[model samples]
Target: MIKPTEKPTVTLVGMDGDMLGTLRCVEKALSLAGADSEYLLKYQNEIIKDDLYKDYNRLLDVTRKYVNVRRLSREKDEEEREKARQQRRGERAGEDYKESGFES
Candidate 1:
């Protein structure tokens, strides 16, 4: 079986609808916003103090304009692999039949 070390990544877009970095960074940033009233309140204060929240709003804006994508599964690749495996099996069976002087 063929396996990939990492999942496929999607790209993020900027305010100008230009390509940004990988979605991994975006996910990391969102995860850093830990939950809790104090943390949330502190975040609010920081947002108000330096307009940090605007970046999230910018992200939302981009999301509204375009679809966000993610890797659902590696099943499609696995299916292709199964097809290749079946082809190899068929070839081997055909070779075996030829060697045995039998119609298969």
Candidate 2:
């Protein structure tokens, strides 16, 4: 049996079409966005308002909301599953159950 302190995480994603995979961690993704903005500095004609960081910030804001919602939905699902399992096991609050003896 194996036990872990934290639940498993999906780290890698498939790359298809215009998508080259993306980071699951928002902070790290934002860091990469900052790097993108820094790279844009090489373009002398680029304006500060056109910086990609701001765009990334906006997108990440929505991403953060989406991530939170998904996490919450997953947590609720896990809780419901656990409750169902407990019910199936005849384990309920202040209740007692005995298994039927029908040995073959």
Candidate 3:
């Protein structure tokens, strides 16, 4: 899995610093665009038919594995965060129960 530090830091830009779209990588963008060829063609023609798209495509080719790794890493991080949060909640509940002084 791609570490947070290892993820690519590229962002697609337009004329005068206007943001076009945020791309994780080429494969990610294509996946998001969906499996329909018509849709893919339209997207290429409408949104990515420019020098920026060319650069994104090149980057995607090089970083496809890195993108997948990053995705897995992110999912793992989220799961860990959730487990920690749940543990904290359980501990808080235990403390509350003790403070309530409900004898068995």
Best by TM-score: 3
What are the per-residue Cα lDDT tens digits for candidate 2 across 1-104?
12222222322222111111222353233334343334323221232344424454444344443233122245566676788898877654324333333323
Ranking by TM-score: 3, 1, 2
lDDT per residue as tens, model 3, 1-104: 12333333333322222223334243345555343445345434544555445564443443444333122245566676789899999999999998999946
List of clashing residue pairs for candidate 3: 2-69
Ranking by lDDT: 3, 1, 2
lDDT of candidate 1? 0.44
lDDT score of residue 73 within candidate 1: 38
Model 2 TM-score, 2 decimals: 0.21
What's the TM-score of each model vs. the native?
Answer: 0.30, 0.21, 0.31
Question: What value does the lDDT take at residue 70 in candidate 1?
Answer: 42
Off by over 4 Å in 2: 1-72, 91-104
Name the runs in model 1 displaced over 4 angstroms. Answer: 1-73
Question: TM-score of model 1 relative to the true fold?
Answer: 0.30
Q: What is candidate 1's lDDT per residue for 15-101, written digit by digit as tens? A: 222223422343333334332345334433443565434465554344332223442235655676688899999999989989998
The ten-residue window of minimal lDDT in model 2 covers: 12-21
